[model samples]
Target: MRLALAQLNPVVGDLRGNAERILAAARSASAEGATLLLTPELSLWGYPPRDLLLQPARLALQSAVLDGLVEQLDGLCSLLVGVALPCDDDRAPGLYNGIALVDQGGWRGVARKQLLPSYDVFDERRYFRPGDGPCLLTLEEGERLGLTICEDLWVEDALQRERLAGPDPIAALVEAKPDLLINLAASPFDPSKPALRRQLAGQAARRLNCPVVYLNQVGGNDELVFDGSSLVVAPDGSTLLELPACREAVQVWDSSGPQQATAPLSQTPCREELLLRALVLGVRDYAGKCGFQRALLGLSGGIDSALVAVIAAAALGPENISALLMPSPWSSSGSINDATALANRLNIKTHTLPIQGLMQGFDTSLTPALGQQPQGVTAENLQSRIRGTLLMAVANQQGQLLLTTGNKSELAVGYCTLYGDMNGGLAVIGDLYKTSVFALCDWIDSPEARNCREDLGLPQQGELVGEAIRRKPPSAELRPDQKDSDSLPDYSELDPLLKGLIQERTTPQALVAAGHDIPLVERVQRLLQRAEFKRRQAAPLLKVSPQAFGSGWRLPIAAGGLCSAGPD
Candidate 1:
């Protein structure tokens, strides 16, 4: 059987548009003489349709769209489209996340997703009831295809720790002795997930003694960015073909043909490249889907803002990206010059709106109310708020999307000001640590990032983020000669601790035992817990890590017991 995998991007809740996209892929596959075409999970409704799946009208519309697909694909080719099947048994969570087979005759649900993941950015169990049995689709050519959805194939305990308890779909498929196994997925990017996926597919292929096809959806859907690094693994546990990552692709594989040459396992790009692509895709899709043609950010000539500007330029074209240099009285000439030089390199427009006047004005207004001028943190935050207000006003006036530049480090400890530095429509790199911000900047300046820069349509030559901007000490520039170190631990020491506390969920005592300072660890833990409210109110950050502070991090804001119970 000639099988084609459609790694296409889908807009959430746009059933008709998604169906059309599926049809276009089907046409391309049919031209290649493919007998069957496989699409990603929830391709019609898009992944994480959320409450849209709860709507009665959208469910009815799904049926109509499927009917249209049946007619549209008639005699062309058999297409397996991912959809949410309505349950007739009147069950709670009245749908089954399933695959529908559409051909010349008609369309019907062929394979239902076995595992319903509820953790981390996914709430499938809220809407979908798990399928009870193994799904095997026997086609006209007598090709027995074992089918599963995204989370069904993630049963390996070695690769994942907190796995969902369910019947092993691969084990059930082994009993059926299927000719091929195909997993339709909407797996999001997590830096290391691509390699892990390949390994999982290889393991499953070896177990089933058949070629395994892993097809995934690609694009940004709110906080989640799907990296479509789809692949076909041979029975001997070797990858035959691997599709491109972070982009849409469609390729056909002939099962009857001779075994193709094994793709090298080590050809994967560096961590920096993968992360950069994911962020770029996230920003591009978020802005495009939200109907913003231009993007705006406060470029303070600091590392965080500078990196955001680079990504914004790459994602929304340099012409579409605009930066507002909102310098306070504390802002240095070197910082202003650096911001301007970086903007000039990227060809992005910039407007200097010095906020010294705004700061003085706020001080004047608050002095009578407070009986003195706001000093220290309050004064610093006033400067940020002024810049944020200016950026928002310009964004509203010019109809541009405002991108927040605060890194994960800032957001984690409440170093960022609420409605100030944290104000924006999307947090592009809010998942990146302050250290990661510097690392990515260094990579952009290095020669290794040249080809990747060219591919991203960024300035392909010479120091995109100049050494001056990158080498400068990390500072908010809200106060005179104020460094981030004055408020928080050095990023070199802090990010690792933050990673342990936030991502690894390590306790302060454990972190201290692991050689971190007890005082620093305890202080950081307290800050992390207390800053939950701020993170809750911050812009939706792009998720590139396994555990992000987005929808996945579900800690309570007012849990005094949890906060007080920290290490003594």
Candidate 2:
């Protein structure tokens, strides 16, 4: 059987657009002589529609669109498209995330999602009811195939800390022992997941002794970027076919013969390459979806702005990426040159607007009766606020989206300014740490840049070495001789402390007892809890970790009993 995996990107709630794309893929697959085409789970409505699943009107609209799809495509090929199905079961109108097999003639069979994953990014329990069984559907090759949606096969492990009904779907399906196993899914992107998905499927197929086809969705959705490295695994535990991550593709696999080696995909791009692509798509989709074109970023010579500039260039063409270098007296000459060098490397336009005059103007304007009693860091902060104001003015004039570059580690310790550096339409790497940011930049400048696909073009930071900047002490340079280390512990020390506190959910006293400095731990914990108010108002963050500081990790801002609380 020749199968086609429709690894495409879908826009959530764009019913017409999603349906049109799926129909187009079906026609394309037919041209390739593929008998059956499997699309990602929830391909019609887009995965994890969240609360949109609640409205009865919306589900009705989705069903109407599905009917239209069946009405339109009758002869091209068969499509196994995923969507939600409504039940009149009186036991609470159950909605199942299921797949509909529609041939040229009409609807074939509907297979509901048996496993409702309710962990991490998923809240299936809040919305969907679990499906009871699987389906053996007819394929053009005269084969009865077993069908399972994403979470169905991922049921080997307990969905929660608690256990549930039935054995793993894949194991149970092997007993029914259809000729082939077709799994539709919308597995999201994690940097480590592409390889893990390939390896997991290879092992599963080798154990099952049957060809396993996995289909995954690709594209950016709000806070998530789905890499569509969809795969086909042979029964002998080998990857027969693979598609590039974050790209839309229709991967074809023939299930009859022993797999032959074709051109292997380029090695996973360096960390910089991964970050660059992720950010580009992140910015592009965020702006494009929210209905904007141009993006404006404040370009300080510092690494954060430089990285955001690179990301903006890749996202909205160089012409669309505009930068304003608002340097204050504290800003160094090297910083200006670095920003200029970065703009040149990216081929984007740059504007140098000195903020010294602006800073003085603000200082003079505020000198009515405000005395300088506690004249320490607050005095230096005025310069940052002035720069931020200048950047906002330029952004407003050009009608561009402002991009803020403050990172996760800094934000964790209240190291950033609220109305100052925290202004932007999106916080690109707000969830990333300082160390990972530099590592990603190194990947971009390495020899591997030559191997990246020409279509998805990356940002080049030029022959202007990435390491010097990488190693140069991380500093805001807001004040003369100011460095990040002056106020906070080294990130080598702080990030691990943060991981222990946030990821491990450790308490302050417990953390100090476990090798953290008592004073530092107490200060860090207080700052973390106090900063909840700032984080609550911050822009949505891109989630790369199991836990993030934004909506993914919500804690109380004023509640005293946050530790091991019942309902955060």
Candidate 3:
């Protein structure tokens, strides 16, 4: 039997459109003589449809789409499509994430996801009802194929492992001796996730001595983006066909013989490449899915904005990106020149809107009420707000979306000006740190970025032509002669401290005690705790790490903690 695994990127809630995409893939696979075409979990309504499942009308609409799918794609191939179905004897008559085995023979089998993931980014316990029975359906050829949704395969509890782990998917499939062990998954992207998944599939296939085909969804859905790195592992545990993560690939597997390994686990790109690809896809999907062709941002001549500009150019075309250089009295000549050089090098449209007059007007009106110069943080924030206002104006007029350019480091410390640089529809690098941001930029500027630029034919050959953005010390440039290191410890010093205080899972007092410099640690720790409110208000960032704000890490809004050297 020839089976096809269709790794798709479907927009959430677009039932008709998603069905069309699925049908097209099925047709393409069947033309090549594939008998069965398996799709990722929840391909019709998209995975983790979240609260949309709560609405009966929405589920009914999805049900209508699923019914149409059963009619439309039957004769082409035996299709296994995932969708939300009303549960049998459910407590509230709610829905379950289910798969329908459909063919010209009509729908033959259904399998609800058994293990609903509740940790990390998944909250499936709030919605789905687990299936009680193990499904082993007989195909037209009188061969049985075991069916299981994503989380069901990974489930292992102490009690279950001890008592009934014998009915594991691979073990059960081996016992039943099915023609193929096909799974439907809606896996999200983590830097290390795909490797573990590939290893597990390869190991399981070898142990069961049967071919295993896994299908995963691709594309960004709100806060989570599914990277489709679908592949087939032969019965011998060798990878016959492999598709890289973050792209759409539909691969056919021959169940008759063993195949050679074309690529090993080592083919996965480096972290820099992984992150660059992720951001590019994130920006592309966010902009394209949101129906915006263009993006605008205030380029402050710093590495953060410059890196964001490069990503925007990669995501949207260089021509579709708009760069604005807003200078105030505090703006330096070096900054103005750097901003212009970077914009010109990128080939993006640029405009200069000096905020001197605007700042003056606001200052004059508020002088009497304040009776003092707008100095320090307030004054610096005013400049940022002015630039943000101008950028939003351009965005409104030109029908473009504003992209926020702050990195996680600054967001962690509340260094960014709220409602100013933070005013945008999406945060490109909000989940990345100041350090990782630089590394990604360097990779983009490397010879590799030139050779393997996106399919759009954007010229990355010159590769970040200007040296200023690369060499300049990172800074907000909100105040005259200001540098980030002056206010906080050097990134080399502060990053590890921040990581210990947050990322490394160390306690505040322990972090101070672990140390090289206690005062700096305390200062950094204090900023981290106080910055909670700021981080709370910030937009959702694409999380590259295991822990990022609003997802893995959740802290209290109130200042309530125990430590002499508190999360200061």
TM-score: model 3 vs. ground truth: 0.92
TM-score head-to-head 1 vs 3, winner: 1
**Candidate 1 residue lDDT tens string, 1-568:** 8999999999999999999999999999999999899999999999889999989999999999999988887657788999999888887989999999988888999999999998888888899999999999998879999999989999899887777998999999998999999999999998889989988898899899999999999999999999999999899878888888898999998988766654464478889999999999999999999998899998888888899999999899999999999877888999999999999999999999888888889999999999999998899888888888999999999999999999999899999898888889999999999999999899999999999999999978899999998899998877778898998999999999999988888767778778887778878888988999999998999999988998999999998754322357
Task: Please give the distance, in angstroms, between residue 97's alpha carbon in candidate 1 and its true position after superposition.
Answer: 0.6
Model 1 misplacement above 4 A: 262-266, 562-568
Tens digits of lDDT, candidate 2, 1-568: 7788899788888877899999999889888888778889889888768888888788778867877888987677678888887765756537878888876566633788777777567787777777777566766568867788876655434222233465566776766777777778887665766666666666667656777788898877877777777888777757777777777898667777666446674566555566567677777877887777998888777777777776777688888888888877777788788788778777789888887777677667666757532246676767667667777887788788888889888888778887788877788888788777777666666766645524455543244335555556778887788898998888888887787777677776677667777777867777787888888777776666656775557577786743431112
Most accurate candidate by lDDT: 1
TM-score of predicted structure 1: 0.98
Name the lDDT value of residue 447 in candidate 1.
97
Tell me each candidate's RMSD, in Å, in order. Answer: 1.4, 3.5, 3.3
Better of 1 and 3 by lDDT: 1
Q: Which parts of model 2 are misplaced by more than 4 Å?
A: 90-93, 156-167, 259-272, 453-455, 458-468, 504-515, 561-568
Query: Pairs clashing in candidate 3?
Result: 526-568
TM-score each candidate.
Answer: 0.98, 0.91, 0.92
lDDT on C-alpha atoms for all candidate structures: 0.91, 0.74, 0.77
